[model samples]
Target chain A: MAEISFPLPDLGEGLIEATVLDWLVSPGDQVERNQPLVELETSKSALELPSPQAGKVIRIHGAPGETINVGEPLVVFEVPDNTAGIVGTVPKDDAPKRRVRLSAVLDED
Target chain B: MSESTTALLEAGARDEQSVKLSMQQALNRALDEILSTDPKTVVFGEDCGQLGGVFRITDGLQAKHGESRVFDTPLAESGILGMSVGLAMAGFHPIPEVQFDGFAYPAINQIVCQIARMNYRSRGTLPMPITLRVPSFGGIRAPEHHGESLEALFAHVPGLKVVSPSDPHDAYHLLKYAASRPDPVIFMEPKSRYWQKGDVDTSDAGPLTGARIVRPGRHLTLVAWGAMVARCLQVAELAAEDGIDVEVLDLRWLKPIDAEALATSVGKTRRAVVVHEAPLTSGLGAEVAQLITQSCFDTLKAPVERVTGFDVPYPSGDLEDEYIPNIDRILLGIQRVLEYRRG
Candidate 1:
């Protein structure tokens, strides 16, 4: 299982923190990308935060009414490892690679 | 001739000629002229240098002034604004574009805390003369976070001069004036009307800190700014046909509003209506209404009315025409105010 982490979005002209209004999704619930995850209030207006990944929410860092800062992790998701071969592994330089012909010719000629 | 007389003569000759140009083109010309005339003036923002900005307001400026003077910045709004504050403190006139009204949120902290306080914090020893140009308003059918009317937020902040231009002429002259001022300015350009052509007489352009009366009427005064000024003009024409004389006043400088013009118009008309594209609750109209009532209480024949957007996140593009105050709403507001007979 791969862990998906949610970061606080930049709000209010370089503002660092925003008060959490309410959470729409709870731990263990499945969420899709761009789905409303939480409601937040800034000095200017109230905003809804969207989920960044499609997965089950494993954990929430803060409760309702708590202020969250930008770039701070807000939620964790368990995503399926679809590209297991590429996950956390470096490509081997010695592996056989395919070569492509720059020009094509007719065999009859 | 004396120096003042010579200057006046030169200005008079310049004012007589009218030039027709779109709002964005006029803004580009103003930047070109200012950058050419002042060595200390600099323009920097996202995609502003080589790309000439998203709307091309800064087009051709990079080639004319070079990259050092007119250059593109990273996609960080906060960094752009904070850097402009430092440049201003160092005695350079920095005009940073926030790209859009919604994107300006990332620079609010730097603007409110740093740029706004630098002058007062330094006790006038260090002056921050940064001009932040933001293209604002709706009706362009842009995506989310593109069209927002947040002028009230900047106007509420101290040490910041918030100005919005209604047309090409105001856009050109106000930008030049903002560059010359010794304080941070939030210069809001009407995004939707950027291509609307208008006649601009570079000579007749006035100072940046005053208001202009666009239409003269005797019944009621309608105060507005930015693109709403143009809408108010249309409303005035319609009202005239309806037999209601309405005066349209454009508050060019939102922060240091023209109290003289406001007072005079309201005193004469005795009835007033404040209109804007922003929401009704706590918008700039609130402040304008308070000021009018406080200053022209005895002269007011009716309570000031406000026609503005609802207190909700700007709706989808399809509903924007209904969401924003339009000519019909203005006419309704005029009718409401005219019907108010003090018992």
Candidate 2:
């Protein structure tokens, strides 16, 4: 068995916290990778956060209406080793930084 | 003097003195300078090629730098943004223009999911350094949806840095800085003030992340950005007549906000009011209020009041005055915060 800790996914605009609107899963429930875990709301809009790994629900960070900050663990899971490897290794930063070069000729006046 | 000599003297005078340029011209200058300085920089957006953008901010750029560095794209915001991400990933600095604030909605999916999440999803392996230029706000009597303040929406997205310039000088320099930064930046230009004049002294400007104390005061601190900074300054001037000293803070960088600068002013003033044209509920004020409460809780003299647009879709052009926050609303909020008496 492997322990699964899911950090709060970025809700957008570099927001740090989100209000827990609703929870789709309960403790001891089986879940799959990328499964909807909970619904959260920010100043912008309501968003559904997905599970990063397939596992059995072990714990939740807060109840509905509670505000959780980004980077804080939102859910805990118990999963098989293969599932745990994919879930726990998810990247924290979502902004792509790869650099490429391009050339476009402009029309003159 | 002879006619030729007179003409030559006038030309010399024009060259000797700085030309009074509109906000769009300032933007052109900045883009032109950056592209000339760095061969890696390139620009693309709708009508940006020969037409020089709808607002003409990109005018003369295609001619000066040649299409190799500056060009136009099809009328597709998502396509523009997606291509920018692809170009940035390949190592080029692509500055895509979203013609108007209203037109940017179609690209929200790409911006929030692809551009913003790319860097974090790739574990820092892929950095989206593209700059999205969104000219927003009202006062120019534009049609519906054209004058929207969606900064809060962009600010809430992680991995995206949101920046707005209240004047021309910052517009020029900030765009340059955004081009150079490693993170993706959403640059919101205030449409109403595009023609408003301000001095652009390149030597004194600082980095893109810092905030500016446009007006220094002690009674209360007014935090604003974009065009609202101009409003705050106006309000501060009026507040002076009523013996209210209001410190105005222009939060140039909305995301990764200048917490220290904000705390310092709020700490001194012991009162605060946030102003913006976006809807009041869950606006940027919510984040700022939380930050002030957590960091400057002990310095509190009053609750942090937010003077923002009503929680409604941006209204028709005629009813915009009611939907957007104005001097009267901001002044009223300031009065409420100042007059509050603890029981």
Candidate 3:
């Protein structure tokens, strides 16, 4: 088993911290990738944080109403060995990688 | 072939493929050029990344630079501008868009108090190298709060360089110039002209300050900037039918008002008229008139006349045409200035 930790993302546009409103999952609860794990309130808006990796929840960092700064570990999860190198449940092979090149001039007559 | 002939031949060939771009496309090219050349340059604002901005000015920038370099921020104007200042202080060039002119009011506190004053207050020790992009002026028939000509508000603040491009050529070059400057700059785009097409010579980019005489004349000087510039030019052409020679000057930079160029034009023409979409009370047009009065006091043959919007909240699209100065209103200013006599 591998232990994966997720930090609160920098809910952009200068928001540095958010208060933990509620935890959707408890310790030992199985969570899927991109699943809402916690509800957080920032300066003026409420946001739901999704799980970055599919795993069994091992620990919840803060209680309800506790403010958490960005980059702080919000949750820790234990995952099977097959998901060790994988981020979330999406396999690297299945995700199509695309690149777009923009030319100096897009259109010309 | 002679050397001069060879140069002429090259110029002729280059003129054939010279791209005909609108103000929106010019801005895209400028942002793409900056992003491709400089890794430190980051662009962000509401819908600027994936959506290519509300005006589509940043179209395809994210596709070219990737989400890390070019991305969208939240709808909060204050947050976007405040973070841009921080990013600049941390040695990054931030191009933060304010979406529209009216939206800029929410960010005015951070813009005027923090970003504008940082360089001067730090005694030049710290530099806020930020370029704020704001789409301003009326005529697009946008809803309320989307078309306020609030250049005067930003121009009132010292240490801030405010620039408005009258055409696509200036939009492309001036945007790059504003981003490259060490001081903070407010790059106001005339949104109404975003679709207006013109020939953009990519090779020649001029200084940030100084006025450009779009049309030269000897009878009267007509001063305007951004969207109003086109109206002035049209009015000048119409005035010629009556044998009134009118010169039009595009005051590119607002904060550092191009007083010398304005004075020179006013001195020669002897009569001056200033036009803008903002309210006449302390509007940018008033500042230009004051400058003309101060510099060309002895040379002036008549008091400078101003044609501007009334001092009231910007109305909805239905009434915007009446609020914004048109050719008829501009002609009134010209006629009033021409009719004035020394006491």
Clashing pairs in 1: A12-B105, A13-B105, A13-B106, A13-B107, A13-B108, A14-B106
Top candidate when judged by lDDT against the true structure: 3
| Model 1: lDDT to the true structure | 0.82
lDDT of 1 by residue, B1-343 (tens): 8999999998778767678887877999999998999899999999888656777688779978999999999999999998998888788999899888899998889999999998899899889888899988776766677768989999999999999999888888889988888888899998777777788988777655688888998888999998788788877876766667789999988998878888989988888999999999999999999889988998787799999999988876767878888777778887778777669
Q: On a 0 to 100 scale, what is the lDDT of residue B172 in model 2?
A: 80
Q: Report backbone clashes per prediction.
A: 6, 41, 0
Kindly give the stretch of ten consecutive residues in candidate 3 chain B with the minimal lDDT sum: B333-342
* Tens-place lDDT digits, model 2, residues A12-102: 7978899999999999999987889999999888988888757799999989999998868788777552220110121121222212221
What fraction of the correct interface contacts does each predicted structure contain? Answer: 0.00, 0.00, 0.00
Name the runs in model 3 displaced over 4 angstroms. A1-109, B2-7
Task: Give the C-alpha miss distance for residue A109 in model 1, angstroms.
Answer: 99
Each model's TM-score for chain A is 0.71, 0.72, 0.75
TM-score of chain A of 2: 0.72
Question: What DockQ does every candidate get?
Answer: 0.01, 0.01, 0.02
